[model samples]
Target: MGADTITRTNRVTALAPWLLVLPATMAVFALLAVPVGSTLAESFSNPLGVFENYRRFFASDYNRMVVLRSFWIAFATTAIALAAGFFAAYLIAGSGPRTKRILILLSVFPLLTGVVVRSFGWMVILGRNGILNNALIELGLINAPLSLLFNQGAVLVGMVYLFLPLMILSLVGVLETIDQDLYSAAESLGSSPFGVFRQVTFPLALPGMVVGSILVFTGSLATFVTPRLLGGERQMTLATLLHEKAIISFDWEAANTIATIMIVLTALSLVALGMLAKRLSPKGRA
Candidate 1:
């Protein structure tokens, strides 16, 4: 074979992998990059000016409050989900295969149901005239039903319920990967159960916790249905506000602005979580 031919063959072999991924890369660019770019462009192209939408977003106390509230809720949900998922995953990790399978199934079964269905189920449980209230009333717990639905607490409950399963699943994989010998060695070294978990298990599981936190935080920030249903008109997060602007008020410019802000915030948060995870991992520490 000619030297030129061999060089061309080598180039083609190197390019083959890129060619295989070209379609997927194009698909992502089309579906995500293009729309996001368009939205950002439209958000800046308002007749009034580029900064007008942003000024409006921060000028109002209500908008500021809503943005802060959204971050707070996302943080709270991520924390709760991680704590709950870690314990659940630890139990599953230590269990026999049959029990582990059953636990995993139960943990992830809610994911099979649609989000709308799950939100409605929460509505039934949390509504004032719903099942819990009715049962409480029947038991003479209170004369009048306490307002349970259409509030921040209700929204938090729904958010936690929605994201907890994802947290559990993320944690399970990490926990399962941990070596059993490590636990035995720790025990042999006279480490208590709590000490072993605190030093070994928890550190090893930090990556999974970070992954779960990223997922839950991002989802909680952008979730519309749960907040809309459970929080009603009282609480308006960024996602709901974006929906209102685009669909109800027909203000695409403002909607685009909010969307852009959300995208940036989500990206920043995920990056921070990734950095934190790396710092906490054994390899990162090393």
Candidate 2:
């Protein structure tokens, strides 16, 4: 080919991947970037000052409490899901083919149900005169039914139930990739089963744990349905507050401010988890 023709061919080859991805890029920019930009702009558009909305949020003790409570609940949910998921993943990873399939199906079955449905299920189990209370009353555990719903504990239970599958699936994908021979080799070297997990399995599973934790933590932070239903007005969370501001009160500025804060919190959490994952990785230790 002539030099000019060769140059044109080289340009097409170089641009091909971008050309293919152009549609997706445009879709993301339109759907995600535009809304985020608008929300951020609206958040700072308060008449009092640029930082007035943020200042207002911080100045209120109730707002501060809501933010702290949201973070605390998210952290607890992530931790519980990670521990439980790791155990379940390990069991599934070590099982025979048929058993592994069954275990995985069971782990994923909950995800097929709607979050609203699951939250309502929790309400049924936790409400006064509900299944648990009625069963306990029949068994003569208490003189009257104990209150179980509309609390922080109930919210935690709902959040954990909703996000636990994500953690399990993330860990299972990584755990299954690990060589079974590693466990055999560790045993051959006189390492206990627990030592094998600590030294080899856990180290290798760090990436999956990080992925799962991020999913669970971020989801727990942003979830509205479960928290709103289970926690009620007494246990207000940031997500519920944001909804109240935007939909109920029609305070766009406050809603946008909360949304911005949530984005920042979720981003910071991802960064912190990334750093922690690196620190725990075998390569980082080496």
Best by TM-score: 2
Q: Write the per-residue lDDT of candidate 1 for residues 126-174, one digit (tens) a residue.
A: 7889999999999998899999998899999999999999999999989
Clashing pairs in 2: none
How many angstroms is residue 249 displaced in model 2 relative to the true structure, after the best TM-score fit? Answer: 1.5
Task: Give candidates' CA RMSD values in order.
Answer: 2.9, 2.9
Off by over 4 Å in 2: 1-20
Q: Tell me the TM-score of each prediction against the true structure.
A: 0.90, 0.90
lDDT of each: 0.90, 0.92
Off by over 4 Å in 1: 1-23, 47-49, 282-286
The TM-score of candidate 2 is: 0.90
- Model 1 — which ten-residue stretch has the worst lDDT? 277-286
- Which ten contiguous residues of candidate 2 have the minimum total lDDT? 277-286
- For each of the candidates, give the backbone clash count: 0, 0
What local lDDT score does residue 5 receive in model 2, on the 0 to 100 scale? Answer: 98
